[model samples]
Target chain A: MAIKVLHHGLATTVQDLGRPGYFHLGIPVGGAMDRYAMRAANLLVGNDEGAAGLEAVFIGPKLEFTEDALVAVTGADMPTKVDGVAQPGWTAFKVKAGQTLTFDFLKSGARICIAVSGGIDVPEALGSRSTYPIGALGGYKGRPLTAGDELPVGKSNLASEGRNVPEALRRRPGPSAELRVLPGLYWHRVTEESQQNFFADEWKVANEADRMGYRFKGGRKLDFVDREQPFGAGSDPSNIVDSCYPYGSIQVPGGTEPIILHRDAVSGGGYFMVGTVISADMDLIGQLQPHSPTRFVKVTMEDALAARRVRQLNLARLREALA
Target chain B: MSARYTFGGDEHLFVECSEEMSLEAFFTSLSMAKGVRESGIKGVTEICPANASLQMKFDPDVIHPNDILKEVKAIEGAAARAEPVLKTRIVEIPVFYNDPWTHETLMRFRERHQDPTGTDLDYAARINGYGAVDDFVGAHSGSPWFVSMVGFVAGLPFMYQMVERQRQIQVPKYLRPRTDTPKLTVGHGGCFGCIYSVRGAGGYQMFGITPMPIFDPTQTTSYLRDFMVFFRPGDIVKFKPIDRDAYDQAVEDVDKGRFAPPIREVSFDLREFQKDIDGCNAMLEGMLNGH
Candidate 1:
């Protein structure tokens, strides 16, 4: 079975749960940004949670299936349609051979996840089907999907049509998001007043945000404690001796704009990372749109762990309910 | 002797060896990383060792964060007590100093440079008290460098020279980052030297270009068949200066999938090297040239 692309949309690519165990080699874990929604879409089609699917940003793709398949659309509220008829997201439905599927302009979130009954059958690179375009590895041809591409689909026996996730279980991406952070990798570098301002103020997401990192605007300039620069650290007051950066670490260069490193970010750098967004809030970061107002909420390690436990339990509950 | 361990949320543990970059600190991190990897911890996803620090990612559901921390602490303690003996390789990488491509790029981004009037090499040479850029190049290529870390991008190795501390070269990064850098551009920033793995934005002071590819996702070359990245953390790299003719030929060989960098196997003993850097480097050079 195959799905031929009619329109590739904006920045669409194949993604899964991402490849682990390779970060030591300087490889970024490129995967579906909103993993919660990706898993939900897969579960709706009765596929394994780590199954590969199409992830599109802003605009959505136009695809024509060559064979019968069960499919589900989740994440952003990009109204999907089959043969010009409107269809609801968070549900599995059947598409017959020669049927066309398209999506409307994004109504809520910045990205949408589309899961077919069988996962996108791309050859795995380093044990993952997720695309890392910077390194030119994994996913479809190690790049974004373009027009005239025919993606092969795997065979599935677990999927059935007319399955839907309950409304209460679904998450809607909003215009504003609060990301929880554990503030202290190099938090000591910033002034106490600036640290307080970082959490107190709402920062607007910049247009330059991408898979690597998100740059935020409209924040007070952070001031670093004065000290003689270390041997290898750059001259910038915000720079530290080169160190490892966490997956969701936040760094402000020149103390003006704060950039939050994401899944596909460089593993380490010289900039002083002040805080890291908790794992529970990373999915929310994926859904954040350009120009969206964001606030960094400080949380203790215990609180962060508790939040992670709740997310895991929710996923388990969803799987049980679907079964 | 004590490593500062911090929580990067609940999923990652950041262990810093020292605030300053030193061979001892790097060895400590490498030994600790090896220990953690060999322990076969169930939830450990990644064990990344940086210049003088180590970061580990784990699944909290399968392993408690504190449990991993305790293990890391124990490993660090053991590493501190014992001498680190690492199995390493010495590789000779060919570089063409003041290559046209990087020279042009440096000229284009001169306004973003610390010294806009002169070329990157000239400025670097002047600041380092060398009379000519050639002298600077000679000093840079004089000794083999240790691959202290391999990151910022896949296959991008941050190398530190094996020379004494007083003779080490230091240069600040660009005043502002350049929008484009040619792939394989050999660059220096602060006290570290690096080769750009892919064409992208960079702030490193451009000095030359390497004719060979350090990273190949396709894994077409014989040397890269087993792994896409050419350099590892403990590897030793010597930058052999080459002329335009050799550079072009090497590039052609790489393009035709026949390029193989000069590689030699060697065992690196941290304690011995710390005692006598020049003596150890001479022995390593003999092994490279003897082959």
Candidate 2:
């Protein structure tokens, strides 16, 4: 054991890039919500891009180091400290043995990723160190870390510290975020007016947001087109015959709440998804806080592809810079 | 063959085979999903087949999304005339009807149910034209079920009855979803039945509880040794109702890692089953008991 948890922050857990191949088994690709931040933290600490790290939400965990090691904190704008002294985020720093690390209240963003010299030394479950609490698999015993839990750290490669990512390299969305969505298969299920309203409306993130999904409130109720209820699809106009819910898809139950499926969502369900948030914007969704004003900007397939390409290039730049 | 293909953002391709849920549509979707997997497509990462639709997630960087779409359309055209046959397995799941665990949970969520005064079973029986709950249970257990999709949660099988459409057991989900549902509780909603793999929020009408655990991450159960998630998409399931004493014995055996369920391998032909469903089903059942 290398790190002892002095205080369990709000919903802190070990995460990596997650197990992608298991989506067919109904096991979601659950990992760090903000993949970019997680990768940045790992890169700063000289760890592999997808190495396991601690994903702390809202608040940060108070941890005491049992051994001197390199560490980096990324994502969010929370203030970090080492044994009462201040520390800069997104920059690798060393903590001496017996030194305590803590955080001030969150200043901005939703989640923070803390990467140490070596990755979290948890045995891989299903070829991943991601925590999927729904299935009770992976991570530190398949659940969120709590106070008094002593975590094991992998053998450090002994890389030098103080490598900070440039300010421009840090990716965070604005306070009022505009998420581009590509409407799909079930788009025709809604009336044209309601579809326009969905794009035009300004919504606020609900308190129900978590790893499974983020629900948006304060939007006009969506209206569905009239159709003979399909056989075997429940009577609700919004219900489909249980279909796959693609990651980042927006599912509206009863034409009310619009939930954007996130990292730990179910693979398939009966609710109809209006559209999917573009892959480039999923990371942005993770950094959004509850009650944040958000807009769903509709985009075409080509637009979505172009955005994905731009983000891929940015990630490439990050890798090159760190390398 | 004219499946409606829609792009799910930059990654997923959603293919809708039919507007309504049916055994034929499920097979059609499954065939396409299987065809995509076997084709060794460069970018396809995951293929999930649902009731009457399927989704394939591909890396757009490796293969352009449109190029993958063209390949999928070609595969759909190629499998258009081929008869669907699945070499699958059939397993018996022992259940205790009206088990006290589910009964207590269902009672707590009565406000969300369709008929608040009556139990879920009685309400379902009345809506489906069954004279009593016993008759409804008989009809439910009498027919074999196909695991059309194993999802919503890990290892949770969404099943469709092998019986004709007119004989299918249908129920609406609770007016509102309950905050809690007992694990392994047999649930029915729409025309599908699902076994809750883990305890969580649910809206389906609770029918019973199974003695066997279909989902185990630890793989501690003897039946789950081959895989942590027991039920697959193509397996057929038959529910065998047992009394309280038998249910207790099965639980005890499961705790001791001695529960080896009755399972058999068999090939399912859509054409043959369509021609003589009951006859083919009887033969399939006979194979299970060595008749």
Chain A TM-scores of each predicted structure, in the order given, are: 0.98, 0.98
Q: What is the per-residue lDDT of model 1 for residues A1-323, given as tens digits with 9 covering 90 to 100?
A: 99999999989999999987777777899899999899999989989999999999999999999999889999999999999988889999888899999998889988899999889999999999999988888999989999999999999885778888888778899889999999878888889999999999889999988888999999789988888876677778888767778899998988998899887888888998888999998988888898999999999988999999899888888888788
Clash pairs, candidate 1, are none
Show pairs that collide, candidate 2: none
* Candidate 2 per-residue C-alpha lDDT over A1-323 given as tens digits, one digit per residue, 9 for 90 to 100: 48999998999999999998877779999999999999999998889988999999999999999999899999998999999999999899999999999999998899999999889999898889999998999999888999999889999886778888888898855687999999986999999999999999999999999999999999999999999988988899999999999999999999998999999989999999999999999999888999999999999988999998899898888888888
Give candidate 2 misplaced runs (Cα > 4 Å). none
Please tell me how candidate 2 rates in CAPRI terms: high
C-alpha lDDT of residue B254 in model 1: 84
For residues B41-98, write the lDDT of model 1, one tens digit per residue. Answer: 8899888988888999999988898898888888887888767887888999999999
CA lDDT of B221 in candidate 1? Answer: 68
